[model samples]
Target: MSSTTHNHTDASCIFCKIIAGSIPSMKLFETDKVYAFLDIGPIAPKHCLVIPKWHGAKITDIPDDYLMEIAPALKRIAIASGEENYNLLANAGTIAHQVVMHLHWHFIPKPDEKQGLGVGWPATKPEKKELQRIYDELKQKL
Candidate 1:
C-alpha cells in the first residue's frame, strides 16, 4: 500500500461536514478510511452512501488504496441491510447527476424487482470483429 497521506478536507463539501461531525447523519459504519451512512432521501429501503474519509471531488482524484478499502464496507452494509441484491453506483460529474462534489458510492438494496436503482442503458449488439477492435484499443491503453 502507498504511504501517501491526505488529510485535507473541503470545508464546503457536505460529505466532509458529515465526516467531521459538524453535520448530523445516520451513520451505518465507519472505518479509518471510509464512512457509511443512510441517505436522507433514500431511493430504496436501505439506501446508503459510502465515502472515503479523505476528501476527493472525483474518483480519479482519490487514492487507489482508499477506493479499494470501500469494498469490505459495501459487503458489510449489504449483508446488514438484509438484501441479497443491491446496486452500487458512483456518479462522477454534473452530467452524471452527481450533486455533491465529494466522491461517494451509493448502495441501494433491492429486495424485489420493483425497487432500488433502476437503470436504462441503450446498448447495441456489435459484431465480434468490432468488439475485438474496441478491446484491443482499450488493452493497448492499459
Candidate 2:
C-alpha cells in the first residue's frame, strides 16, 4: 500500500491495527492493495480473512480500483489452502452477523461437513403476486 493509503486507517479498528502492524496476525499473504491473514478463531483449517489495505466499514465504501484486487487475493488464499472446495463469504452489517465493521472476505476451506462455514437455510415462499411486485420494484431500482 502507498504511504498515503496506509494512512487511510482507523485507530479504533482492529483490522486497521492488524494492517498497520500494531496488532500481530498469523500472516498469510498481502499485496499493495489487500492483505490476507489467518483468523484468530478459525472455523476450519486454513480459514482466513482478506481485507483491503484501505479501511472500509462495508463493501460499498471501497472504491472500484481497490475492489479490483480482492478476487485475485481470494484466489491466491484458496489455492494455498490446498482445498478443492471452499467458500468465499462476506458479511455486510451487524444485523447480518458482521462482527468486524471493516470490509473483509472470509476464505473458509470446507474439507468436510463439520468444517468451514455452516448455516441452516430457512426458506419461505410468498404468493406469486407478492414476488412479482418485489421483482418489479427491484428492477426499477436497478
Candidate number of the best TM-score: 2
* Residues 1-142, model 1: lDDT tens digits: 1112445688888998888888999998787788999999988888999999888879988888788978898888888888888899999999999999999999998777788888899999999999999999999999
Q: Which portions of model 2 miss their true places by more than 4 Å?
A: 1-7
Model 1: lDDT of residue 46 = 87
Per-candidate local distance difference test: 0.86, 0.87
Model 2 C-alpha lDDT per residue in residues 7-65, reported as the tens digit of each score: 67888999888887889999887778888899989899888999988888888898877
Worst 10 residues of 2 by lDDT: 1-10
Q: What local lDDT score does residue 133 receive in model 2, on the 0 to 100 scale?
A: 99
C-alpha RMSD by candidate, in order: 3.1, 1.6
Over all chains combined, what TM-score does candidate 1 have? 0.88
Instruction: State TM-scores per candidate.
Output: 0.88, 0.90
